[model samples]
Target: MPDASPTLGEAGAASVSPTAVLTIYIPSEAPQDKVTRAIDAILAAHPWEVPVIEVSETRLVMCG
Candidate 1:
């Protein structure tokens, strides 16, 4: 007997992938303490134990 599994071209054959993006905004007038806490919270919630962190004058990016 032949196997029953359908080929990639069949209906429901292709799998769907998921993605997530996080963006943080810091105002020019925001306090340093508040900014620190916000960044800390973001790092704490990230999945990676040691995420690669990068920053510029305006933004921060964290990648695992």
Candidate 2:
């Protein structure tokens, strides 16, 4: 049987599956301890882990 999965040209088909973006904008004047705890909590909530091969200033290169 042919696959029922949506192809690239289909509407609402996300180019990257299971995508997430983490963006935090704590003011520079915020307390260090509070900021640290907030960041820790956010990270703890999303516990998914991937095997990253390299990390740079701009991007993360994950292992295939």
Estimate, for each residue in 1-64, the C-alpha lDDT of model 1 and write its tens digit: 1333432234435544343666656787889899889889878887644455555467557899
Whole-model lDDT, model 2: 0.52
Give candidate 2's TM-score: 0.44
How does candidate 1 score on lDDT?
0.61
Residues 1-64, model 2: lDDT tens digits: 1333443334445354554565555666778899778866765675333222232234457998
Candidate 1, superposed: residue stretches over 4 Å from native: 1-19, 59-64
Winning candidate number (TM-score) = 1
lDDT per model vs. reference: 0.61, 0.52
Worst 10 contiguous positions by lDDT, candidate 2: 47-56
TM-scores of all predicted structures = 0.49, 0.44
